[model samples]
Target chain A: MSYKLQFAELLPYWNVLLQGLIFTIVLTVVSTVAGIAVGTAGASARTFGPVWLGRIVAVYVELIRNTPFIVQLFFIFFGLPALGLKLSETTAAFLAMVINLGAYSTEIIRAGIEAVPKGHIEAGLSLAMTKWEVLRRIVLNQAFRKIYPALSSQIIIVMLGSAVVSQISAEDLTYAANFVASRNFRNFEVYLLAALAYLVLAMLTRSLLRALGRVIFKAR
Target chain B: MLQFSFWDILSNLLIATQWTIVLSLIAFVCGGIVGLALLFMRTSRIPALEWFTKVYIEFFQGTPLLMQLFLFFFGIALFGFEVSPWTAATLALTFWTSAFLTEVWRGCVESIPKGQWEASSSLALSYIEQMRYVILPQASRIAVAPTVGFSVQVIKGTALASIIGFVELTKAGTMLNNATFRPFLVYSLVALIYFCLCFPLSWWAKKIEGRLNVAR
Candidate 1:
């Protein structure tokens, strides 16, 4: 069967594609911010909180890390409604991405925190610096510097994972791709374009994170 | 109200869990085979072959698996080949798995000291002999834990197969939710089963790494 490739068919839907890309980026940015907050808090809880709290954080980390992100998204999107806690598709997707990234980053940040020398904390104590001040001024920044690479990779993984949110009609990049494909019956071309878009997004995200890292960490 | 008894939901989910396991296994085995070959090509000194394999890994790793599954599901059918959900999931996942495993194995192989390769070469070992007798033996020790850890990822990945209509755990949960309207129970049960399947593997991988670290 001779088939001609038709990239022209999708030309009209370029705005939808652009909107989808924006939503995808919006989700990633929101989730990255929320996830880092959740992760830093969880990491500190696991590292320096009371034993019981640490154990609870441990369980949360394991549960999130072990299961699939898509399952977690489904649970939030579908399951929560049953519990009378209704969330929009976009909200559910954002919550799931943050939760997923938070769990993984907890571990990453924990590793970085552990790598901080015990003497550093003792020195802060000897200087009469409150524990919170030490953590804020010294430990947290150093931990962020140390684990920035792993943390960025996890963020990218979550970005790629945002594609699954399309399954629930979240109107992300993949959702728009699906919309255009179903409309034009150009499944192959549409998906091929979607794949390329994701590839470019991944590369762009990596470089952006790397540059961001340089600015934030202020190191070579 | 369509009454799906608690037992009814449990049994249906238990059955669907089997497909999840099956798809993960297929992807793991097939991806391992393909990944090993890719690893060799990437590690080889041939510039063209190395470049080709590097590009292959990046393409597969950089793109999302959901897109790959969609392409295989509909792309093959466009060429007049009837693509079952099972076949499409497995094919895309295998490629996805190979890309990651190749990179993982390369890290292990490269972790071997530079002097080891020089010493083996000076001792008149051929490239193949050196790999078999020297490099592989050392690298396999490092590779085993990560490879098993990666199985959890492979299992979780099979969940996406449901998007294309593969009746895995996630798919089963969605279907049962539709039928029973007990989304909370169905999905909670589904997530629990995944945790059960994946947690032990992750725990084992960590345990192995702990032991290896102590040994090192």
Candidate 2:
């Protein structure tokens, strides 16, 4: 099957594509930070909180982890207004993302938290550190470093997952792809190009995360 | 002013749940076949074949399933071939699902000790024989938890097909919400249906993972 490549015709859409990319990157960064914060809290709850708290964490993690993210997105984008809380489309999309990311991040962080050596916590305690200080300075620091690579991979996954936001018309890269495909009548070529763009974006994200890791955990 | 009614929406919402299950099952089964082929290709000694498989996985993994659906459902039609949204949805998801499942299964396959592969080969077992009698049986155990876990991804992924007019759970919910004008109450039911379908699988996957870790 002979297929024509139309890379040149796509040049005019570069600005739009660039805008979409910027939007995606920003959403990813915001969600990643929020996800980490929520995930860290969830993980800590599961690891050290009381039995009831752990059970609540388990329910949240399991529900989010099992379901398709798009389903979760739709639930938030479409479901919540029935409860008398109405958010704008982009707000719904962004909030859905944070919730979804938070769940997956929770499990990943929990694993890291669990892997923290007990002896290290004891050593910190011996140094007269308060319990909270020991956990923050010793346990969490080691856990974050250990899970840096896993967390980086998860962030990329979240970045890619952000494409679902297009359903709510948030104008991200996938939404832009839909626009280009619709206008240019080059569905295959447009999507193929979009796929390539996503690949480049993921590679860039992975590298950026690694750079962030290097600065944050200079000991590595 | 989308006034929400509880039981009115709940009744129809229950039916949408079935479509989600159907789509997930279809995608998972189709992906397994494609995944197995890709796994075999990865293990092949041919460098080009291996590179092709790698590229295939990376492409699917890197892109969101949403774009792939648009490309397949709309892209094919642009080339003068009419594709049903259902077909496009299935094809795109099957392709995407294969990538992740193959990578997951391949890891399980390769993680089997090298000595076992060598032992089977030294015993004059052909490649297929070695895989069937020695390698695969053990790898099957490792593959189970991850493969089951990956199915949740497939189930989740089917939701993307709703954009192309496939009336799965999310699509149904979208339409219902438009008509009923009660997005929140309608969608919470949708989310609950999805949670019902996915949670058990997630639990089973974790149960297996814990056991696998213990075995290791």
Candidate 1 lDDT over B67-119, as tens digits, reads 99998998889788899999999999999999999999999999999998999
For model 2, the docking class works out as: medium
Clashes of 1: 0
Model 1, A100-214: lDDT tens per residue?
A: 9999999999999999998999999899999999898778978999999999988888899889999889999999999998899998898999899999999999999999988
Q: lDDT tens string, model 2, A56-103? A: 998888888777787777777666666667888788878988898899
Stretches of candidate 2 above 4 Å error?
A1-7, A82-84, A214-220, B1-8
Query: Could you say which candidate leads in lDDT?
Result: 1
Q: Which lDDT value does model 1 have at A156?
A: 87
Per-model TM-score on C-alpha atoms: 0.98, 0.93
Identify the candidate with maximal DockQ.
1
- List clashing residue pairs in candidate 2: A68-B156, A78-B183, A79-B184, A79-B187, A80-B184, A81-B184, A82-B184, A82-B185
